[model samples]
Target chain A: MYPNDGFRELDRQECLRLLAKVPVGRIVHTRQALPAVLPVNFSLEEDGAVVLRTAAASELVRAVDGVVVAFEADEVDAATRSGWSVVVTGPAGVVTDPGEHERLVRTGPRSWVPWPQEVFVRIEPELVTGRALVGGRSLYGVRPPKWIPARR
Target chain B: MYPNDGFRELDRQECLRLLAKVPVGRIVHTRQALPAVLPVNFSLEEDGAVVLRTAAASELVRAVDGVVVAFEADEVDAATRSGWSVVVTGPAGVVTDPGEHERLVRTGPRSWVPWPQEVFVRIEPELVTGRALVGGRSLYGVRPPKWIPARR
Candidate 1:
């Protein structure tokens, strides 16, 4: 059972762990009527961000880039009474630059099995929040990235 | 490993089974520059349709009713080397009648965690497609509803 209190913030490590376990996630964006949510196969980048592929003409490709989008992944283990969810809200951009595209392509095997028309889009997270359900207790929290001082 | 030829078409029973196993699904719609997909917790109605709940102010609420929306749910079992997916494309509408709403609320417990602001939306499926990966083979196909004779 979740606590009656408000959702708690999650740490960076906890968020990353939750994101890694879920293979499919929901990408939320504003559409014509209300916000729309779609599921897609996703992978974690070296920097703990989310990456997914679609078609060049895919609606996903068009709405995500240069827009603020929310990506979420989660897993639930009923028998063990545990589950975790991680959400990344950030501005998304297309990776047209050869170097960045190559990096994403090589990070992992292509997981999406979409129709012939699909392209890839990646989300660079700005805010991350996660929650873990353990023994019927929910632990939730938000974590911001750490910043280091710039060297002169 | 799925067959080189791709996934196989699944039957109605298979589609329902696959749908029950997955917790998250994507609802795709066009509003922004491209199509938008969002993650949602859904329930299968008694009449063999999908049901979703959202707030009255939700953009989805405005766009879904009497609109063609695409709903997809899938599950992948890596260790077993098997997976299945089901896609429903059809017209959606709000269930405003009191009797229908009560029946849904009384149906088996809602799998989704409760949200304070919830409005129910129902999808009247027009076309259904499903695919399954089994024994290194991928099967795919579509199922349209049967036509009934008119009554005197």
Candidate 2:
């Protein structure tokens, strides 16, 4: 991590690592020129693609096919006032190959929502970026405010 | 909540009520024609506007002033496979009036990032929509698969 301002920039590998760790993220796509953000259960694959399952009737399944979209995932600790966030931008391609779809279903993150999530989509990342706020480290190495509790 | 498929739609008042309960959300905006999704700590006002603080040098402060943006917030239960999400769309107007800015600072959500967050942006919602997946309810009213865990 390279510190920039009070946050540090994470390398691509670190960003992908974190992306794989989290099961839920928000996918941002444009609908009729207006941006729409939807939460999704997604998984990162070995080739750096992000995969997600959705219902066939989902608006996302319809709108995001072959479209450039943004995926964002993060974890924040309110008690410690710190967290890491990653964003990936890419083209969202629907998984149409039956064999590939079957493999993805067995490997990718599953939706927590109880719906028929039969459609699979993959995002081939064009850009990956991330930032982290190290719990006890300020930009200039000053002591944190007493009000901020230390992490366990 | 009126059921649509396996999800239920929440009205405006219910949407705002849920928005006020969460302190963090992802704000979506367009940057150079591409959608940018950012994690932000935000709060809701009595009149249904959303407010958040960011550093003056932040890209969000530069890109979102007087622009329409999408804000999404949600909570999910991993154990019960249930969740609810709310999305708000509106113009993100920078709070420039001194009294108004101060009042927002006194009540709006504060950033946990260790930087000087001097810019305040408010999103007065023009459109609000939300959906919730109630626990124990399937779309077809059939018993959920045994793979699905029961609510604790």
Candidate 3:
């Protein structure tokens, strides 16, 4: 459980690890009266960012800009009684730059299921938060883990 | 593969099956210049509807009223060279009635992970749509299956 004072901040590498283990995640963005969330396939980037794919004219692509979007990924190990979740909140937009898109194609966004026709989308995170559940019989309480930022 | 006209509309039972097989899906809503797509967990109700969970104070509760929110679930069977997708688009909103909430609890959502403290949200679908992929050798195209309206 997070302290009421604030959500514990996670370092970049820890966030990356959490992102990698979770197969599915929620993307939250503003719509009319409130925010909306959708699920997408994603991969962790070398810079500790997130990348996913969508159709070229996807509504998700249009929502990018000053909007605050959140991408959350989590994994739970029931037998071990442990789990972790990472949320990357930042600016999102379509990767229109030809050079950047090509580079990403070469080195970023690995997919569990192959779908090469999908267009790639990138998230530049402004805030990264995460929590880990540990202890039980192997039992313990859930709490936010210590975070260290990735070295730039 | 579907014909150029559009993917076939799916039946209610088929939509339920597609929902059960996929672990992730997107909830799409329109905002400003673009539409917002967020990932969410959903399940097929006994009445052949879809149910989800979200924070009571979530924007989703507000945005879903009378608006067209698209809930999509899909999966690909690589070995069989087949895949199928179901999309439920309709009016969505928060469910606060104790009776309704309890009924949903008894039925359970299709979540791989457990979320004991989460709140339940339900979507009354107005339209159900779907498609399927078949064939082993060729990259078959997509086509619409069928469309069904919600029960009055």
Candidate 4:
């Protein structure tokens, strides 16, 4: 039992369950053909769609529309040094239907920033995968080194 | 004052400074032509390299070696609904030099899991970007919905 890797693969149900627990997650998309990470507050839809509202004019809204992107959310406990990370990879679409937009506006994620105009982006979870890091709490924390040389 | 967007852009030095404060970050890479994310505990080297050690046989080690990836870490204070997120984008290279590997062994990240054989992957910070979500603490938390339809 000890030799077994503590990295446990989670099932689809569990992955989505964990996804619903966190309010913030990083959205991974390509900007200028290179990966870019943006931390955004998100809401999980009933159909496993990861929905987030951003400013209408925000660069992310335009860049991610109809594009495949990855969303990740996780929680690591300090005392246990263990947690589960779930990644959802799928295509993102800006919610444009007035009816659907109204539904989301009434029961969607609270805005982290107030913007003049905002739009909803929904990411369909086409591929879901996650791992649980468990049973390693021996190391308390790394001592803060007095200094780290400026990398310039 | 409130007219300004709550998200204030951070400069390079400040971005690295925030990156150094967190031990855990998510590494975004491509798997099967689709983006994937993994939470890793990393250390900052003097040369601004983000280093993380993982099992030698891990798929990520092979998938990310010499490939461009994105690394992000952030801190959120539930108190003020404010925090900073920093992302570093660059190419990842596995430590092949014996001397460098040993050097990392002496002062690298403490493993959250006990892996028998681990390899260190170093990522250069080519493009560093970050933002501060400042001043929005009114809403305490989101209440959980009583039910959600399972997506099948």
Scored by TM-score, the top model is: 2
| Poorest stretch of ten by lDDT in candidate 3 chain B | B143-152
Tens digit per residue, CA lDDT, model 4, A1-152: 00124456688889999999877888888888888787778899877889988777767776789999998888875455577878888999989999999999989987654455878899999888776765434332322111111111
Candidate closest to the true structure, highest lDDT:
4
lDDT of 2 by residue, A1-152 (tens): 11234456788998999888877788888776677877666789887788887666666666788988988888876567577889888899889898998887788767554454467789988888887765664543674321111221
Better structure of 1 and 3 per DockQ? 3
Candidate 3 differs from the real structure by a C-alpha RMSD in angstroms, to one decimal, of: 8.9
- Global lDDT scores for all candidate models: 0.58, 0.72, 0.55, 0.74
Instruction: Flag clash pairs in model 4.
Output: none
Task: Give the poorly placed runs of model 1, Cα more than 4 Å off.
Answer: A1-13, A23-41, A53-70, A78-82, A89-94, A109-120, A127-129, A133-152, B1-5, B9-14, B20-42, B52-71, B79-81, B89-94, B111-120, B134-152
Q: Return the TM-score for chain B, candidate 4.
A: 0.81
Q: Worst 10-residue stretch by lDDT in candidate 1 chain B?
A: B143-152
Using all chains and alpha carbons, the TM-scores for the candidates as numbered come to: 0.58, 0.84, 0.55, 0.83
Ranking by TM-score: 2, 4, 1, 3
Shift in Å, residue B2, candidate 2: 14
The fraction of reference A/B contacts recovered in model 2 reads 0.20
The sequence of per-residue lDDT tens digits that candidate 3 reaches over residues B25-53 is 55666544344454455677666466776
**Every candidate's chain B TM-score:** 0.75, 0.82, 0.70, 0.81
**Of models 1 and 2, which has the larger TM-score?**
2
lDDT of 4 by residue, B18-64 (tens): 98987788888887788877777889987678998877777777778
- Interface RMSD score of candidate 1: 15.2
**Chain A TM-score by candidate, in order:** 0.75, 0.81, 0.72, 0.82
Considering lDDT, which of the candidate structures 1 and 2 is the better prediction for this target? Answer: 2
* Candidate 1 steric clashes: 31
